[model samples]
Target: MTTEDSARLAWFKSTYSGNEGGACLELATTPNAVHVRDSKKPTRAQIVFTRQSWAAFAGFTGRPR
Candidate 1:
């Protein structure tokens, strides 16, 4: 998506993210995909993932190491 397209997305930070300004990320989701970007540098590059791919990643990360 273009910068303008992404700008219109309803981005929100992860609930786990703290307010202390450490590492943090924001995410925006659509029916088909998910968008992720650094909360501190929203204007920079962002990574987009298919919903299935994102769900797989989230499932893996949710598992115990």
Candidate 2:
């Protein structure tokens, strides 16, 4: 999606992000894809991944605590 489109989604950051001074990721989930971006630089280009791809990545990463 374009940056304009991504701006419309509700982005969420990990709990650890605050503690680490924004050194973390943020995500916006949509029906078909998940949007990922750096918490430190939200306006930068983000990565868009299919729901299935995101799920596999989450599984491999073991989900953030």
Candidate 3:
């Protein structure tokens, strides 16, 4: 599999991410993968997740059932 460039990663902060930068986690989603990275280290190693796995993880963010 080919890894993507940090610069090319289109990072999107959560709506909770205010100007204070307390919530700095960034996410990037591609055709078959989702990426999670620290906004503080946008140029460093990023966590990769398969589309299916990401869907599960993202679902948890909605509510703790």
Residues 1-65 of candidate 3 have per-residue lDDT tens digits of 23456567677986657789674888888998988888777777889999999888777867667
| TM-scores for all predictions | 0.86, 0.78, 0.72
lDDT scores of the candidates, listed in order: 0.92, 0.85, 0.78
How close is each model in CA RMSD to the real structure? 2.3, 4.2, 3.1
Q: Which residues of candidate 2, in runs, are more than 4 Å off? A: 15-18, 61-65
Q: Sort every candidate by TM-score, greatest first.
A: 1, 2, 3
On lDDT, the candidate that comes out on top is 1
Tens digit per residue, CA lDDT, model 1, 1-65: 78898899999998889999999989999988999999988989999999999988877956578
* Candidate 2 global lDDT: 0.85
lDDT of 2 at 1: 65
Which 10-residue span in candidate 3 carries the lowest summed lDDT? 1-10
RMSD of model 1 against the true structure: 2.3
